[model samples]
Target: MPTRTASCTCGQLSIEVQGAPTGVGLCHCLACQQRTGSVFAALAGFAAPYQVTGSATEYVRTGDQGAKFIFRFCPVCGTNLFHTEDGITGRVSVAVGAFADPGFPAPQVSVYDCRRHPWVQLPPGAVAFKKDPP
Candidate 1:
């Protein structure tokens, strides 16, 4: 299994994941935009056994559907490093940008297409959803 490590801007927090991501996606929801401070947010989800190092601060946000997601950030840099759903287990979603690799695999899924900026283009062949996929 290949391993990859992602760190915050200040290098205060990092996560090491073994193997390829189970899911790579882009989110254009309002909440995601706000959380990422960008037009969209890209995330890669990995299964359990991943390792997290250093301390972090957490912010919990409730989704539109009432599900809760816990977002963890670097305490020193305030960079949003990863997030986990309230009830979902065995997976963590890390900010793809944190990897700082331009060649990282493109997103396979795009959610909240309805909220995507008009000029922002989606990667070719990416599955898009007006909202969260069922």
Candidate 2:
């Protein structure tokens, strides 16, 4: 098993996860854009047994479905590092940029395409959804 580390810009907060991500995806929802300060958010989900170090500040937001998303970011640098959702246990979704790896896998899926910018392009062969998939 290969272990990968994702860290904050200030190097104060980080997570070490073993093996590949269970899922990787992109989100173009307004909230995601606001959270990332970008056109979209690229995320990778990993199962437990991962390790996190340093302090984090959490922000909780309610999704369109009413589920609460608890985002944990580095307090020192204000980087949104990882997050967990209500009812989604035993896994953490990390920001792909936090890994700082150009070779990180491309998103396998894209959600909220209806809100996606016309200039934004999805990776080739990536599945896209007009909205959240049921």
Candidate 3:
């Protein structure tokens, strides 16, 4: 795994992922939509021990499990960079659009599908979940 550098649209915030992603996913939940102001959020969960540089504004929220999750973003550019939860085990799910190069890999699974807009269709055979996939 090579060290990869990622940044916000303006390069105000940067992150280094020292290894590959755990899994790539899509979230169709209302929270994600409202948070990102998008139809869906494309993300990649990566390994821990990453070196993050620059300033990030964080907002903490209690999730469905009553666990705290930190959502980090660049205040200047308003790009939601990553989200981390303890349950994810020291990993951060980086917004795919923020990746310097997300490349050929697309999301493996889609979560919060029940909240998905009716017009937003999933690829054939892609798993769709009403809530959390598991």
Candidate 4:
């Protein structure tokens, strides 16, 4: 895949990601829902060499598994752009919706299934976990 750009709602912050995503997944954790203000969050992971421009603010929080994560968002628009965990090295989970591309790849995994909305439907063959996979 070629390079793709993702921008915040106000277009004040953006990122240029090269190559294809290493992974794509959906998170149904309450923190994800609260952050995105939606039922869940769709994220695409990219390794190093990605370029981010403009300013962003970060919020750090602990997950159910006792791992800490930093959520980065556009300071101007408050658009959640990406996040990184303490244990995850050299990769970022970008908010798929921020790309504003309908043709973006579908999620390969669905996590925190226990918190997923009852009416939410996932891809037929997606790998799902009741909670974070071990």
Candidate 5:
């Protein structure tokens, strides 16, 4: 597997994913939009038993299902680094845009579609689920 390196836009924070992503998905919830300022947020989840260099700010939040999701990021660039959900993959979801690799595969599924804006058309080829994966 090809290890990948990524950092905050200002390069203040950096991380190395020793292998391929654990998965990828699109989240259309309001929180995701409020965080990314995009129509939706897509992240490349990776199970990297790695270290994070530089200080990061964190926001501990609970999802609709009450799963604790930790939002971690760089304080300098204000980039959203990763998110972790309880009892799922022990890995974090890394923003694909942060990766040096531009050929990042798009989301595999569309989550929180119930909250997706009607103005934005769903991206082709993604399984549109009303809620998160089961």
Candidate 6:
């Protein structure tokens, strides 16, 4: 199993993840775009047993579907690091860009494709969904 370290912009907060990710995907939902200040957000999912170091600030918000999500970020740089949903347990969604690794694997799935910018092109063979997967 491979271990990867992801850090905040100012390096104030870091998380170490081991083994393969449960999933890798891109989100083009409006909330994601606003959160990342980008057209989309790339995320990697990991199960429990990951190690997190440094203090972080958390913001909780209710999604359109009424589910709540807790977003964790570095207090210094305000860089979004990871997020977890209220009902979901034992999984964390880390910002893929936080890893700052060029060799990271491409996203295997894309959600909220309806909101994806027309100019954005996903990798070949990537599965796309207009909304959350059923």
Q: What lDDT score is found at residue 86 in candidate 6?
A: 88
lDDT of all the models against the reference?
Answer: 0.95, 0.94, 0.82, 0.92, 0.81, 0.93
Ordered from best to worst lDDT, the candidate numbers read 1, 2, 6, 4, 3, 5
What does candidate 3's lDDT look like per residue over 8-103, in tens digits?
Answer: 888889888877788888889778898889999888888888878889999987866577888988889987888798566778878888875737
Model 1 score (lDDT) = 0.95
lDDT of 5 by residue, 3-102 (tens): 7877899998877777777677888988899999998888888885856888899998788888998888999889987777767765878887888676
TM-score of 3: 0.88
TM-score of model 4 (CA atoms): 0.95
Per residue, candidate 2 scores C-alpha lDDT tens digits across 43-119 of: 99999888999989999999887889999998988999999997888899999999999999999999999999999
Give one digit per residue, the lDDT tens place, for model 4 in 8-126. Answer: 99998998888999999999999899989999999999987788899889999999879999988999889999888888788888999999999999999999999999999999889
The superposed Cα distance between candidate 1 and the true structure at residue 71, in angstroms, equals: 0.2
Top lDDT hit:
1
Which runs of model 1 end up more than 4 angstroms from their true locations?
A: none
The full ranking of all candidates by TM-score, starting with the best, is: 1, 2, 6, 4, 3, 5
Q: What lDDT score goes with residue 70 in model 6? A: 95
lDDT of 1 by residue, 1-134 (tens): 89999999999899999889999999999999998999999999999889999999999999888889999999899999999999999999999999999999999999999999999999999999999999
For residue 79, give model 3's deviation from the true position in Å. 1.3
Evaluated against the true structure, the overall lDDT of model 2 is 0.94
In model 5, how many backbone clashes occur? 0
- Report how far residue 7 has shifted in candidate 5, in Å: 1.1
**CA-RMSD of model 6:** 1.0
Leading candidate by TM-score:
1
